[model samples]
Target: MARSSTEAEYRGMAHAREIANNPVQHDRTKHVEVDRHVIKEKLDVKLVDIPLVKIQEQLADVLTQAVSASRFQDSLDKLGSGDIYAPT
Candidate 1:
């Protein structure tokens, strides 16, 4: 079975970090293409480390945003405004 997306992301970030540190083309790394766009985008925007937020924290943030948006829409529905709010 293939690795999960989250595992792949973690591996990609680790690979990117290793490539950033070494950067030299070698037999082991020659086949691996680091996503330059991701690195450049991060650097251009001055983002430092890729934050390793806890799963609960991430879930909380996502759920909170989702629920808050849903509540607003529910309120609008109750008020018969027919406004639609998409969950974040």
Candidate 2:
């Protein structure tokens, strides 16, 4: 799950730090298991980057919940889904 809040992101970083510092526990993290280490590994190796996406530009909003018409349209446009329907 992608973190949408700053607090959540901070917690994730803290967890990542713990994983890096503790070799034994890193493999046995309760919340962040071995599978989740791929992301941290990528970050450690600088292979991937986390871009700051604004809430308005979050494409998942369109599928996850109800939103204002304008916000819905914004997400749809950002995700390039506008071609699905003819313009009025």
Please name the candidate that would achieve the greatest lDDT relative to the true structure. 2
Which digits, one per residue and each the tens of the lDDT, describe model 1 over residues 1-88? 2145566568878867877577563445654445656686887888956778754344333323444665655555555665356554
Evaluated at residue 79, the lDDT of candidate 1 is: 53
Quality of model 1 by C-alpha lDDT: 0.57
- Candidate 2 per-residue lDDT, tens place, 1-88, comes to 4434565578879878988789788667755555578889998899999999877777886775668998988877777776646877
Superposed model 1: Cα runs more than 4 Å off:
25-88
Error of 1 at 88 (Å): 46
The alpha-carbon RMSD values of the candidates against the true structure, listed in the order shown, are: 10.9, 7.5
Deviation (Å) of 35 in candidate 1: 8.7
